[model samples]
Target: MTNSKLLKLPSQRQLVDRLLHLIEFNHPFIFLSGKPGSGRGTLCESLLNGLPDTVRVVSLIGSAAMKMADVRQLLLQQVVARPLFNPQDALADSFFRMLDGKPANLLLLIERTDELPADLVGELWALCRHNDTLASPHKLAIIVCGNDVWCRSQKEALKGRAMPALELEVAPLSPPEQRIFLYEKAKELKIPTALLPKPKVEEILNGANGHPSAIMQSLEDIMTDRRPKKRQAELPVKKIAIVLALVVAGLLGLSYLPLFDGMGKEETREQPQEGALPAPIGSDALETNAASGAQASGSAVNGDQVARDWQSDAKTLPKKVESETVTTESTNYEGRRVVISDEVVEKLMTQPNVSGALPTEVVNELTGVSSAGATQKSAPATPSAAQHAQPSAPTAQAAPKAAVPVAVAAPKVALTPVSTLNKKPKNHYSIQLMGASNTQAVDSFVAEHALAGKVWVYKTRFRGSPWYVVVQGDYASSAQAKTAIRKLSPALLKGQPWPKSFAQIQKELKQ
Candidate 1:
């Protein structure tokens, strides 16, 4: 038979033999080590393929590869005849159960075994050693596959374990093996042996360093490049360079066209006009001064006597304007002062009524004026309204007379009965059930158990299904539900009800 259709690699027979031996002897622990790209994974697949269906293999890798909990879960759930228990107890119990002397075979193929923590490895080793004494009859096996670096580091940890272990190193193919590999690959691609030409095949094999994956990749590249001789053509370097230069110049022109065009349009639009006058201001004041000058000129034109008359009139006009300005200023100042005084009074009202003497400056600002006549004019014949409204003086004067009466009145109210105020009733405990299919069964069970009026049932949907059942009531403790479940014997009821927390039941119904 030709080796053309097979994966021709080094050390194939030896690895196959060792794996078979491990299976036959029921070795519980085996480690496969090799450099990356030395086909460790492929070797494991081949060995697994050769095994009988009775042997179940569980493979784990990558980030999920190291979690012992995940490993234990797979062992319990996926393996045939595996036992189940609470996770806390399942850790030790499951290992023992798998190790018991049953004839059925099991192979746990853990890839990237180096990722597992040291403590987990130690625990696993301990189980492999002591499992026979703890459980019944069956053989449990674990096969670890990883690179040489991982194997070297973990060798000490695997020592002294009861399970016989072997470390198989897979090396790269030799020159003869490379030749065989290329032949098989070429045939698989359906390429005739003569068409590959010995020199080209050998060139590919040498460049690939005899690695199967690299060699196969090169072969694929060579096969895809096959073309008819007549259509193939090669361009001179000068021609190629000219073509590339033209393409690059075109791309650069295309990139800058929009930017230069926008700048040119903006510059054209901003060109200035020939002549433009600025706007006029204060024109009304200039007009008024011009009118005054014209009036003075007209008076001179009338005659010398008229000029004297205009001079008197001009003198009176200036004085009258000054007087009018002063009167307007005085009126505005008085109005502003009154507004300021009102604001001050409002600020004083906002102040807390604390016992303190007013500051001298504040008293002066409120009562003193620029002239004494102003203050005298402001002060009233009777006390001002603010002085009459002062609360401290009146309260002090009335306190002594009111004390005894106020004290006598308080005792009368204290002597009255205190039973007039109402008290709230105590809360009653109750439960409402939601999403329950068999309400009558739950109600009857509750009534028979003397839980009537305490528990209720309601129907709802859970996870888009009409199968949701909920029971509600006052549960003194979370553990009370478990106790209730035992008494109710849910399996014997109309539907096989399971114990679930109130929060969980409510969440399911909401969904």
Candidate 2:
């Protein structure tokens, strides 16, 4: 077993030294308890390595073959057939039976002893402790390995007669340990040194959390692929050129299109033509002379121009309509379209304004009435009635009142009241408590020293001031704060004295 070269295990140097001492002193039994993966078996191997070749090692990893009869048979085979079994009971028995004075060195290593019957383990320990029963002059040593739960159970079963068990705990590796582990794994994998810089190597190690298995696996992944750095060099320049070219083309296209000029001219044309009447004639003559007459040409030209203007105006109409719709929809106006339903429109004919009050021209357009005579006859009387109804044109006199000066009350000064101004706000005091540039550190310190439920933390800032962390109304006074400061001094300012008062501390925070 010692001839097999194994990788050195982590964190068992003290155990190895103790075991060596035990073996030299011929101590009979040793029980070792540790967490899983705590290198118990490795320590045993180290002890075996220090021993002489004449001393044989019998390693029984616990299994179903742990009954007393199986133990006796195994002992018989080792002493009679092999004679090389270290700590062999058969050899001890045979020596007592035959030679009775022969000396030998025997070491027995048992792994996972918790699986063995409780009675068998107790009996074996008793035999090893009392070597006077056998005549052999040889030394006997037994080492047992098991995890915490199993070891605890076994100890409880032994009822205080068991050998003293040494407990070992395996801890996760620290940052530096992780880096060393990664470096070793990289060497084993024959990874090229230049592929990763020292900082990058440290990053990989930190990412693996110092576990040997994780470190090796990460190193393997890093070694399998080599990334090239040169591919990144030309990418930024290419992207910048593409973006600049697109921006330049967009600006040039925008410069040639006279967007506002065309819009202003179209507005001027549509406003003058909006209420103008169409050319009128008898239907028979209009249809018969539509292709040949000069009057038809004029009407056709006007209609074509109006249609073009309408199309252009339609493009700009959405802005005006949307503005009016948004303003009216937001108001409390009741006459506006509240609910546009199919049923409402079907009832439109029964409404009061359906024919008479509505403008004849608008009614004609909706009804598809082509008689231009009806529109000319109705237009003159409609405005006449509207003109005669108002006895005193109150609209002329009320127009200025409609403007109503809108009182525009000089935009209220909105000064903060004198009473509010007089009281120094809590935030002002808080800002003074929390020091500039060290607010987070101060907060953490306060939290660490605070008694769990007794203290409450608050943070605030005044206008043009730095933020602060405040521990409000301490149950204990300044002396208590001083005591807490002393206790936490190591974690704070290297055992320095605390500020004398809360106000002083707040001032220091502001500074």
What is the C-alpha lDDT profile of model 2 across 1-511, one tens digit per residue? 1112223334444556667777778455666776654445655667677776766676777776567556655554554444433333433344334324666576767777777655556665555644644555467676777777776666555444334534434334566555655666667667889966888777776665544445555566677754344655455888899999999999999987797779888898887655766555433333444354435435443354321111233543454333221122525766664333343344454566664455544454455564354434434456567557765676575355334332111221121233432243323221112233344455454556542343333333546565443343332355565555555435444434343444443443344
Per-candidate local distance difference test: 0.56, 0.52
Residue range 89-153, candidate 1, lDDT tens digits: 44456655554555546677777677664455565566566655544534567777777877766
Q: Could you tell me the TM-score of candidate 2?
A: 0.33
Off by over 4 Å in 1: 1-10, 26-28, 62-66, 80-83, 86-91, 97-104, 115-120, 132-137, 162-164, 191-199, 221-511
The TM-score values for the models, in the order shown, are: 0.39, 0.33
* Residue-level lDDT for 182 in candidate 1: 76
Report RMSD for candidate 1.
Answer: 23.7
Off by over 4 Å in 2: 1-10, 26-28, 64-72, 82-101, 115-120, 132-138, 156-175, 191-511
